[model samples]
Structures are given as C-alpha cells and as structure tokens.
Target: MIPSDDRQPPQKGLFELYLEDMINLRHPLVRMAERIDWPQCEQQFGPYWCPDNGRPGHPIRLHVGLQMFKHMQGLSDRELLDQWVENPYWQYFCGESTFQHEPPMDESTMGRFRRRIGEEGARALLRMTVELGEGTGTVAPGSFRVAVADTTVMHKAIAHPSEARLMARAHRRLVARAKAEGVTFRQTYERSLDGLLMRIGRYAHARQFRRMHKRLRKLHGYLGRVCGDVIRQKPYGQRSQALDDSLYQALYLLRQYADPKHRPKLYSLHEPEVACIAKGKARTPYEFGSKVSVITTAKEGFVLDCQALRGNPYDGHTLHEGLMRVHRHCGHLPVHTLVDRGYRGSEITPLSNVRITGKQKGKGTAHPEHQHRRNSVEPIIGHLKHEGLLDRCHLRGHDGDRIHAVLCAVGFNLRKILRRLARLFGLRFIQELLGLLRESGTQTGQSMNQVVSIPV
Candidate 1:
C-alpha cells in the first residue's frame, strides 16, 4: 500500500535523542538537503506506487537520493549502501531525521526502483538537476538559450567480440539451458570446451590462422550438434518459450559467425542489443555499445539533455531528434547550438533565429563565439565518461542504455551544484569571520590594522 504521511511514528530511543547533537548541520550535504525540493520529488515519483496493495514502500527521498548518490560517486548499488550507512551527511541528504545502524534498502532495491521509474522518471531526475542548476545560479537564466551538442559511445561492459569467443559463448549457453530444462543432449562438450577455447586463443595470438579456423569450426560444429539435440528432444510444440528463444539466438549466432556478409551481427551473448560503433579513434578504433548524444549549456557546463541513439547512425542525422529532445526536456529550444564539424551537412530544419555552428563559412561569421564553444563539450563528455557513470553501462537492454545516460548527466549536474554551494557557503563563512575580527578589534580599542597583524 502507498504509505500515508500520518503513519505512526517510532518511539525515540536514547541514541536517537542524542543524534542531532553529534552531527554537523553546516555540512554541504545538509545545506543541499535544505535547498532540494523533496516534496516535489515525492509527488513526481509517488504515482509509480499503488495506493492500496503491496507492502509500504521506502520513502521517495531515500530511493531518489540513493540514485543521485550512486551515479555521483560512480558507485555500484552495494557500495552506495555501505557508504550511506557510514556517512551522516549522506543520511541527511536522503532526508533521514536520525542516524540508523542498518542500510536503508538492499542492493536489489535499486534495480527495482530503476525498472519502476523507467526512462521518463530518469528524465525527471535530470530535469530536477537542471532546475537546481538554475536556482543555485550555477547556470545563468540566459545560458539555456545556447546549447552544445555532441555524441559519444557509452561502452557496454562486455568482452571484445571475436569469432572464437562468440561461438564458445553460444555453445556454453545452449548447453546450460538444455540441462536446466531437462532436455538431454548426447555431447555437452563440458570438459573439452574450456581447453578448446584456450587453444583457439593461443592459436590466434601466435598468428596461426589455419589452426584458429580449425578450432572455430570445431566449436561451431559442437554448438550445432547440441542445438539439434535440444530441438529433437523438446520439439517445436512442447518447448518452453524461453527455450525456443535461446535456440533461436543460438542459431542466429551460428549463422552470423559462419557467414561474413550478415549486415547486423550480435556482439555479446548476454547483451545482444549491444552495437559495435567505430568513432575513428587511433588508439581505440571501435567501441562496443550505444551512441549517446550529450547536450550542455554553451557557457556553463550543466548538461541539458542526454539521449542514447540506436543503430549507430551518422552524427549529422541525429541533430533534429536531439534538438526535439532538448525542447521536450528543457521546455524551450536553444536559440543557438554549437557543435563540432561532424554535424556539417545535417538536415536540420532552418530556424530563422537559431544559429548552428559550422553551417556558415566566411571570414566574418554570424556567431564566432559558437565555434569556440564547440570544443567545450569535448571535456564535458570526457568528465561524463570518467567521473560520471557514462564510461561503461551495466544496465540491460536499449532502455537501460537510455536511462543510464540520463542518470549520469543528472549526477554530473548535481555534483556541480553541490560544489558551487560549498564554495558559496565557504565564502560566506570567511566574510562572517572577517566581520567578527573587525568587531573584536573595535571592542579592544585597537584599529583594524592592529587586528590584521595579530597571529596565532
């Protein structure tokens, strides 16, 4: 059931009574907590829950705060929980009234929360961060009029694909599934598979192409035999839907591996949705994952929007949709967009006032500032990949790719806001300290110059 605000309060124990006395109320997290719109978040997220069924869910702030903390720190769910328990500042950020010895929720709870909120909810979190940036003055009111756009590959957490590895993984999955479903196979290749894979790797590394081809063919043959056995045992009519899907994927992998002309190929066995994208990098020639478009304000580094594009389309083709997403999320289209030369020849519908960088060429440009701002997004993308969670996405499927990208942007913006607030508070404290010193100097019948010379 949806928990009511009037739920009975727990009796305060001795430890709870003394908790506030031990914690620092002036911490950045505590100040940020006061600044955040918790009620708005609760209202936005509260609809995902049923009002009359299911057990009472955890507070919305706890779940939301956990997500922000997760991507902000680039931590997994387990690590977030461990750190949350030890840090009182984190607890206060989550709206906890008093410290607790136990974790707020289990590691799996984060997955459930993500699935429940889905992509739209993730975008809401991004919007909240954007709003916070504006309210905190980190991003100026007019900055939203100008946005920078760029695309980067958010690599999937999977091994680099190879012919041998693909065939071996397919064989192992088919064997494991057949055993689980009680469908007997003549030869599972259980003992020989590992050694065969090892030999294939060694052959490839040693530049022995002939031996590598032989092992790959052997592995492929083993997979096909096992697949046939499962089909014969389970048959078309009696097989479970999951078993049928597995067999289909195994067959698809076998076909793609055997042929060199398949247009779209599966790269990872577990994550079939992963795509191999080539971004023309010398060191890293190819990246295996989805392409993400990152939009940020031209002057300030706050992220405006993040969207995952499928099929690895040209960077130019994604501009129209990227602008629409910016409009949808930010409530207005940027009056001008600064992008790198990759976006040249893009079929962006011309807006009379909207200025796009690199579109016009001449000695004197319409907006030369936009061209200079284009390179700013490069470092923003780097920070999103390294400091934010956009380096490697661990969530499943295309939906996971989109949601993870948005959340990473959210984390980036929140971290910036927190730092700005910390600086603001630090300066205020210094100003107050100077005022106190001046007042003390006056009371001691000494000039401010005399007080300035006093040392510890």
Candidate 2:
C-alpha cells in the first residue's frame, strides 16, 4: 500500500510541484549554471537512448544536468526536484518549460546513470567545466610563477574491520540475503556468526591479556574458515558487483590481518587499491583519500592542473607530472613555478626556470618566499573540503574517488567565478577612487614646487 506521504493530486501543474517560491539571482549555484554552455555539456555527456525506447520522457541528459547542478550546490535529489517543481527560473535552467509536469527524475535513476557513465564521464564533465573557464578568461594563462600545492585524505565510509568480524559479517549477511531470495547456501552461517561475534567481542573488550589473546586466536580461526567458504562459493558475484568488490577487499584485509599495533594498509572493500596517504597536520594526522595534486595560477587562482596521484608518493616526485598536466591544460609551460619545502630536493634544485623552496634539491640555497607561498594552497584545500564537498565521498573505488575530487575542483572554480563577478563592480570602484587620489596628490606636489621656485 502507498504511504500517506505518497498520496498526491493527479491534476497538479509543474509549478505546483515545487516548494520554492522563487530563484534568487544572488544564489551562487544558480548563477554558475547560467555561465555553463548547456549545449556543449549536453553533447559531451549525452548517452545513447531513444525517447520511446528510453525509460520515459524527461531525457537522461536533462536529469543528469539537474543532478550535477544539485550536487555542485550540495542539495539532495528530492530537494532538487522539489525546487525545480516550484521555481520557474530553476525550471528554465534545468531545460523545462513552464507547463511541464513529471517528477524531475527518480533518485535511483541518477545512481544508475552515474554507474552507467562511470568515472570517465564525470571527469569529462570536469574537463568541460575547466575548458569553459578558459574560454571565459576566468583561468589566467601561464600564471604558475608561484603555484601552491597540498594534499588531504578523505576517509572511506566503513567501520574498521577485524579478521573475525569481517568474515562473520560477510558470511551472515550474504547467507541471509540469499535465503530470503530463495537461494541455497552450502554452509551454516548462523553458527559461524554467533561463534565469531562472541570471540570478537571478547578480543575487543577483554581486560585480561591472556583472555584477549585466546579470544583473538579463536576469532581468527573461525573467521578464516568462513572466508574459505565464501571464497569457494563466490557469493559476491551472485549478489551485487559492488558488494562483490567489497567482499574481495575484506578477504584481502583478513589475510593481511596482524597485531593491532601494526598500521593497516589502505584497504576499502569497495576500492581495494586505494592508497594510504599521510599529510602532517595537527588536526587531521591521517587521511584515506587518494593523493590528489592540484596546481593553480598564481595571479588568478585558477586550477592549472588536478590529478589523483597513484600511491602515497613523495611531494617532489609529483612536480613533473603536475607541471605536465598544467602544460596540457593551458597549452603552454609556465615561465616560473613555485612549490613548498616538501618539493625541495637535490634532483630538482638544478632545474632551470623552476622555483621550488626548502633545501635545494642539489644543495643550492632555497628561496626565502617558498614557504610563505606554499602556505597559499592551505586555504584552497580547506575550501575544497568544506565548501566543495571533497571532505567525504559516497562513491566506491579509486576511479569514483578520482572523479569525485575533480568534480569538487570544478565546483570550486565555478564558485570562484561567481565571487569574482560579484566583486568586479566593487573592485572597479576602488580602482577609480585610487586613481583620483593619485591625481590630486600630483597636482598638490606641483603647486608646492612652483611656490618654492618663486621664493628663490
């Protein structure tokens, strides 16, 4: 039966669907949507699907575009759809007419679309955004004279796993779901779960050292057996591919399990190859996201290059790649590039035209301003984390993580454009005022010089 919330009138107009009374010009996300080339974005992201043969009316392109805008503004899908229904301006931006009516698009459809398009499509969207910025002169050309770079970790969305707990959970959940769906399982999962959970709880909470060790050993043994059964059956493939990936990763982690004192390698059931990255900060000592490197134009603060670094590589090692990306994006190499102390090294010191701080790579003296300039990227990273939604990611795997990071960067650039446009009038006013002050000062100085000459 449909819930009370599901009941709605059949004869509602498109405008009647939305709750928002109006779309304000001052809304940053709305303004950003205007600057985008909708035609180009559509052409780039438009997938193959016929109108009748497709899911229904309201093309997938329109749905995807609306969803992207919503995410860029950090709105939920339901909220976005509601806003579209009520506000006419939002309807116009989303490619809807005044009288159209059909709930914007199902939330599940958006997820399926993201999965269908994969990370590559998302990256293309980000690239298009960057290209648009370049076309608009928002991204200044060759301004890498002093580029700032930093790294942060975005933690995965899962609890810390244990050898016993992982195996038990996977086994129980898989068996239960399969049984409910009327599938057969060779092993008894309930017994395994109870035994494993009891032992693990002991290991986790036991105060006595001897009891803890015994409980942990038993837990390991039980979980090891469960892992063998699951691997043998390969239940992951039968259920969901995403779940399959997660189970495979959990199995790998179980195999690598050791003392709690040992550091856990970056392992997510969803994205096994995710790297373990560490950026030395007082507040956040460790981060789980890929080592993403971004270089921006010093003058305009436009992103020149953004790439998800493979492995937790050294800061200096990424300089060449970062520069290459910048060159590719801007179509020219920067005359001068500035980096932080972490990038300083003997190998890089002798490089001509590149300005890096800290101990010169080969013993040449470091630049005094390098540290201060390197500090500039700190705020950019903070902005991406807090405002651009890079702080946490909901997608699975490295590719998903990479695409998410790039999108956040795109959002950041769009926001920068919005603020720049807003401040342009104020900045022009300040410039004019400064010019008048300078002219008046010059006239007064000339009068003083003439009076001195007459006295002489």
Candidate 3:
C-alpha cells in the first residue's frame, strides 16, 4: 500500500496557500488597509441576516464587496466571476471557501447592490480609499498637496438622438415600460415608430412632409393622452410615483419641443441629460455627455474629486467644488492647485491658493516646472477615458453620471494600489531570497560562514 504522504495530491503553491503572504510586507496600501477600521467602513453596506435565527453575513458582505469594488474598477462582473473560479488570489479576495460554480451574486444582483449603495455609498468608498492612502504613511496628512484639475466627457449609452426622434422614442419607451409594469392607462398607442422615423428621415417634398408631420402630430397627441391617463390612474405609491416622475419629466420635455418654441427642449428617455458638448479637440469633435472635472494629486496622481457638470460650464466656475472635494478627501485644503488656461478667470485668481497657467500678459520669467506639472493631469484624464471606465456612462440621470466618474476614480486608485503592492513584494522577495541564497552557499563563490543581511 502507498504511504499517506505518497498518496496525497501535490502541495498547494505558496501563492495558492495565502494571498496575504503574497502581499509585500512593506507595501503602503496593504499596511494602510490593515490599520484602517474596515469593520466600520464596511458597516455602511450590511448587516445581512440569515433566514432561520439569522446568522450575520457581515464578513461575506465586506469581503464580497471589496472584491466587487476591485472588479468594478478592473473588470466586469462576468469576468470577475470567471477569475474567482480559477484565480486563487481573486477567490481569496472574494472570500470563497471553495472554487464556487456560480458567482455569489448574478450580474443583475450586482447592479441592484450598486443601486442599494447609491451615490453616497460610492462616495464612502472613495473616502475609505483616501483614508487608507493617508494612513499608509506614504501621503502626509496635511501635505496631501496640489491637485491638478481637468474635465473629460463621459458618453451616455444611447443612440445619438435628434429632437424629434428623441421625443418620439422617449414617449414610446415610457408608455411601453409603464404598461408592461402593470400600470393602468385609459389609452395606449399601438402604432409603431417606423412611420415617425421614416417621416423624420425623409424631408424631400414639402407637401408630403406636412402630411407625414400631421400624422406624427396625431401620434404625439395620442401618446400625451395615454401618459395623462396613466398619471391620473396610477396610485401614488413609491415605485409608481418614481416612474411617473421620470416619465412625466420626459413627456414634458418632448411636448415642450414638439411645436417649435423659442428653444427646442432636448429629451431622451434613455439618457435625458445626454448633452452635445464640444471640447474642440481635433480627434473628438463632440462628446455626448456632461463635462466632468477630475482633480488629482501631482505627487502620486491619486484622484481627489470628480464632478459631472451639466451644460459644460466654463472650467473656472467648477473650481469651488473641485477644491472642496480635495479638502474633503485629504482632510485639508490644497495649496497651490494647478490648472490650464480655461480655468483662468478673475473669480479663480482671487483665491491665492489656486495657481493658473496660461499666456502671461507681458513677457516674464516662466516657471517651467509649474507649467510641466500643470500638464501632468492631461494624461491622467486620458488614462481615465481609455484605460479606466470613464470613457462612457453605463447608468442614467445626473446621479448615474456622477457615480460612473467616482467609480472610475476608485478603480484607478485600486490599480495604483495593486501596482505598488506588486513592486514592493518583488523587491522584498529578491532581497530576502538573495540573502538566503548567499547563506545556503547557493552562490558557490560566496563564503558560506559569513552572515548575510539584505540592505534596506
């Protein structure tokens, strides 16, 4: 018979054995995570209880949440779930006892969980990251310094909508969804949008076009009656009220623009505030969402604040909120914040703390270092759009846009943390292993008896 040891499967790898062990001893983020009151931070999410006498799922929630947060930054839920099955590191992070066949929650469940957390929860997550950074001894408390500011457009996830098309689509979608959800109505239009689309798409003959427009007008009027009936009939309950509020808002905008007024109101049920913002870049002539300003530290490039401003306000106007977020994140106001020419204005110049870079009125000594540092944030904006998840907004409403931006910032910080952890781990591993090698006479030429200590 084979011995027990001989019969056993191969020993689990050091990597598979423990994730904490894989983490570098001196990695700042790791050290910071350990020091923070994660229990307190995690309390914001859960006190999940079991059904029978209800055992708490707090540990599971926290672990799973942190894993989700990582995934929200680095990968999709489907991709993360796949990794959890195969990668020990990911499984360990997610608190899996065994390689699970299914994810702890489905993708839709993940979305609901995010909604439950809402914008406030996302902000809390950001605060936790900032706090962790501060506790790490890497960033000094008061010295969380200059945050460079810039804006990028996050596109809404709907087809580019024209005024007429948007109104028609918005009206149809609201009615369809409302009806499907069992909301009562006196009348609902059975007409398809094909005719409306055709009429709008073809504009050759004035006489025929007016005939088509009259038909479209009748359809719009019919939709309005259906919406009004639904509004009157539906009970004033939580869910229905919320739906009604949104539907009515869309309907209001559509009707406001149906007949040409001084200004045509833009409306899209899918993404109501999807604006046509032009930033004047040669590559991207126009972007289809609100302009969001992101501010980050110059020292380590950690994002301090992000805001989704509607109507693409001038950069100078958003300064107060940006600076306020920096203060909130760092627990101290930033000194000598840097910005480009767009942010230069009398309103901004009054704040002695903010240092604006642009063409000087007269030739004077230029601080090349400040100008260089001012431009540093531009790459950060690109990274957020290209690599991080801020290129497009998957959610709807202004709140959704804000959440997307915050999640991107959080994702970026996590990536930063992972890179720092990997680098530190590698350096320490090489040093300690090299010393061990010297001691073991692994290096044949080295004196075996000599004591070997790794240099810091």
Candidate 4:
C-alpha cells in the first residue's frame, strides 16, 4: 500500500518543540511546501504502486522532494541524501513535521523510485511543476499561446570515444567475464597490453601515424584472439544478461574497426542511444550525445516541454512531434510556434502558423512583433545546462535520457517559482518594516527623523 501523506500530525509532547516554530515560515521553501497540493502528488504516483503485504512505501512527496533537490542543488544521489540530513528547510519541504536526524530513504531507493515512475510519470512531474507555476501566476496561460523551440545536445557521461580506449575496455571486459563464467581464454594479454595501449596513445598524440597504426594492429590481434576464445566456448545462450550484452558490443566493436575506412567512429559501447550531433561550430565540430528539442513560451520563457530526440533526427523532422509533446505535457499547444533557420522547409505542422523566425523577417506570421521573442529560449536552455542537470546526463539508457530531460525542466521551473516567491516576500517584508517604523514614530509623538527599533 502507498503511504498516505495526509495523515494527522503527531501531538506535541510537553518538552518537544515543533519544527514549524523553530524555522522561519516566511521562507520561500516553507511557503512553497504549504502551497503544493500533497494529496494530488500522492494520487499521481498511487497507480504506480501496488498494495502488497509489505509495509507502506515512503511518502511520494519525500522521494519527489529529494528528486527536485538533487537537480536543484546539482547533487548526486549520495550527495543529496547526505545533505538532506543537515538541512531542516529541505526536511520541511519533504513533508517532515519535525527535524529528523537521519535520511528518510537511501540512495538505492531513490533510483528504484525513478524506475517505478518511468517516463510517463516523469512527464507528470513536469506537468505538476507547470501547474505550480500557473497556480502561482509564475507562468500565464496566455503566454503559452506563443512559444519558442530549439534543439540542443545533452551529452552523456562517457569518456572520449577512441579506438585504443574502446579496444582496451573490451579486452578487459572480456577477460573479466571469461574469468567469471569459468571460460578462460588462451592468453589474457595481461603481460604487455598496457604498454602497447599506452604507446598507441602517445604515438597518436606525437603525430606518429605509422607507429600508432602498428601498435593498434597488435591491440586488434589481441582482442581478436580473446574474442575467438570466448565465442568458441558458446557462452551466448547460458551466460548472464550483462555478459551477453557485453559480448554483442565486443562483436560490434571488432567489426567496426576491422576495416580502417569506417566514417562514423564516434560510438559508445555502453550507451547505445548516444548519437553524434553536429552544430557546425569551428571550436567543436561535433558533439556526442542525444538531440533534445526544447519548447518554451516566447513571452514568459516558461518551458512547455523538453523532448529528447533519438537517432539524431533532423531539426525539420522534429517540429511536429515537439508541438505534440508540448500539448501532451502542458495540456495546451501554441497557436504560433517560432523556430530558427534549421526548420526552414518544415511545412507540415499541427499548428496552422508555424513561423520560421528567419524567413518571416516581417512577413505573414501570427505574431510579428514577437520575432525577437524566439531568442528567449536560448537563455533558458543555457540556464538548464548551467544551473540544472541538463549539461551532462549521468543516468543510464534511452529512458534515462527522457527522464533526465524532464527533471531538468522541473528543476528550472522550481527555481523560477522559488525566486518569484522570494521577491514577493522581500517586498512584503519592506512594506511591513516601513509600516512599523511609521506607527512607532506616530505613537511615541516623535519626529520622523528620530529612529525606533522594531522587534522582529
């Protein structure tokens, strides 16, 4: 059974102090927690859980609160949990009634929670952030009428894809698996493989192509011998799932390098969904990651959606689908969609007025004065990378990419909401201070120049 978040508060003991009394309730995080509908959040995640004989799971708010904190603070799973223990404001945001000494959940439980939510539930989380923005007037519904969209590369957490690195990685993996599966190869190449791989790297760096090629051939021969030994044992049908998948990658890498004429050399053995995206920059010619389409309102810059495009589809081909994602996530679509020159020939669209910002210059689009508004999304994307976790994805496969993109959006909107609340709180505080000062001087019958201290 899912843990009910709407339970009654515990009765305060004679000597116990409440967390609400200890902390400043005017804090933005405290106000944010109060405004969030916890029951609705529990309902969104209730279907994903099953009513078992096991004890009730942790409250959905706790897990989701940690998730938002993870991205908002740019902390890893372990880092977030460690800090969660020290921060009482964070505890209050997660629905804690009293200050806790230990973390509510572990790092592994957080990972399991993400898996349970999946991509659809991740989108639901994004929708909830959007709804939070709307309810607080942080994002206006009318602003969603005109939106800007752009694509960016969200890099994967992998080393540079080089032949030497891949070959060494494969050889080590094969040797480890062979040892684990009780199938030993003839020569494990443990004696001199390190020197050879090192020499190969130095040769390439020193502009010694001939030496690099010679050392690479030895590495290739060593890999081939080990691969042949493992394949002969026929571990495919009987080995563990991980080993089987590693063997497939080894085979793919072997075939990929057997010929020197392979064009697309940028490939990751571990992450199959990663693609090379070329944005035509002189400093960095190609980026190895996934292409993500970002949609935000032209006026408010509130992100409507962030769609991770697989297979590195062309920008023009992704417009219609991006709009659909915006509609699905935000419960509405833009009457006017603005895009850049990359989507020039994108004629087929769900919206009747798909405005190419460059082509429209001042032509037949629905919103002409908002031509410069398309550039608003660029800063938002930049913020997502810098302030949020969209810079480099640390999660695993295709599903990880989708979930991470949506969470980054959630973090972005969360910050905006918090900032708005903080500003409004600041103004209210100043107004109250002025009122107190005026009342103090009037009651004391003193001149306005004389000062009076107000007890805060």
lDDT of each: 0.84, 0.60, 0.64, 0.83
Cand. 1 TM to true fold: 0.91
Ranked by TM-score, top first: 1, 4, 3, 2
Deviation of model 3 at 397, angstroms? 2.8
Cα lDDT tens digits for candidate 4, 1-456? 677675336676676556787899899999889888878888889888876756788888998899999988878899999999898899889988778888888899999999899888888888888889998889887888888889999999988788888888888887897779888777899677789988998999899999998988888888888888888885468777877877777777777788666644537877876887888979878888888899998887888889777768889888888888888877777888888888877767756367777674445544477777878989999999999989999889988999999889888989999998899888999999999999987877764335554444
Give the runs in model 3 whose Cα sits over 4 Å from its true position: 1-37, 43-73, 134-143, 170-192, 202-264, 346-352, 361-368, 440-456
RMSD of each: 4.1, 9.7, 8.4, 4.4
Tell me the spans in candidate 1 whose CA falls farther than 4 Å from its real position.
4-19, 179-182, 350-361, 446-456
Clashing pairs for model 2 are 18-85, 18-86, 154-289, 246-269, 345-361, 346-361, 346-362
User: Which of candidates 1 and 2 is the stronger one according to lDDT?
Assistant: 1
Per-residue lDDT tens digits for candidate 1, residues 1-456, read 554443224765664533456677777777878888988998998899998899998888888999999999999999899999898878777767777779988999889999999999999998888878888888998988878888999999999998777777777777787789898877788688889889999998899989988988888888889888998888888887777777888898889877888969989878888888988999999999999999898898789889988878988788888888777777888877777778766635563133456567764645656557877898999999899889999999999999999999999998999999999899999999999998887878766568889997
TM-score of each: 0.91, 0.69, 0.73, 0.91
Give the candidates in order of lDDT, highest first: 1, 4, 3, 2
Off by over 4 Å in 4: 6-8, 235-241, 260-266, 360-367, 435-456
Give residue 283's error in model 2 in angstroms. Answer: 4.6
lDDT of 3: 0.64
**Model 2 backbone overlap count:** 7
